[model samples]
Target: MKITLIIPTYNAGSLWPNVLDAIKQQTIYPDKLIVIDSGSKDETVPLASDLKNISIFNIDSKDFNHGGTRNLAVAKTLDADVIIFLTQDAILADSDAIKNLVYYFSEPLIAAVCGRQLPHKDANP
Candidate 1:
């Protein structure tokens, strides 16, 4: 099974490295990693470019927004069997997170599946 992991980022330099590290630690690595960047002023672009398994999409328009950027990234991987949309600040709690997500899709009737997110120590509702 193959999955396309799409991460929408904007000035996420402080958090992206953690996200990338979590991705690398996944027990089942995604077939493709797509990073949709919205004109980051930090080293996000350069850092993403330096990653071996990641593909970066730099959206330079001043009007770039998360919704639009995510739509564009999804459009680029329409052929993928599963699209995993992740935020730049999100980290996989367990190594099998991706495997569990893909496992849920084995059911023929399942069109989509979402998992519960544990509250981050630094996140506020």
Candidate 2:
């Protein structure tokens, strides 16, 4: 089973390093890591390039929306069996998150499943 994890970023900077590290720690690492950046002025490109497992798609446009960038990333992975959409700031809690997601799909009736998201201490309710 091929899983494509798409991360939408814009000036994410060091935040992306943690996210990618978490992905690497996952029990089921993604087949591909696609980053859809909206022309970040920061060192996002260089940072992503340094990572061995990441494949970045820098989306250049005058006006960049999160939804639009996400759509473009999804469009690029047309052949993937499963697409996992994640924000640049989000870090996976457990290594089995990806494995769990794919396991649920073993049931033909289950087309989709969303895991619980715990808010960070700094995050507001």
Per-candidate local distance difference test: 0.82, 0.80
- What are the per-residue Cα lDDT tens digits for candidate 1 across 55-89? 88877768578788888998888778998998877
Please report, as a residue range, the 10-residue window in candidate 2 with the lowest summed lDDT.
44-53
Provide the TM-score for each candidate, comma-separated. Answer: 0.88, 0.87
1-125 in candidate 2: lDDT tens per residue?
A: 88899888789856668777788889888888798877889877777776655788876756578777788888888888888988777878888889988898888898888877777666656
lDDT for model 2, on a 0 to 1 scale? 0.80
* Candidate 2 lDDT for residue 118: 77
Task: Tell me how candidate 1 scores on lDDT.
Answer: 0.82
> What is the TM-score (0 to 1) of candidate 2?
0.87
Counting only residues 3 or more apart in sequence or on different chains, how many pairs clash (N, Cα, C under 3 Å) in candidate 2?
0
Worst 10 residues of 1 by lDDT: 44-53
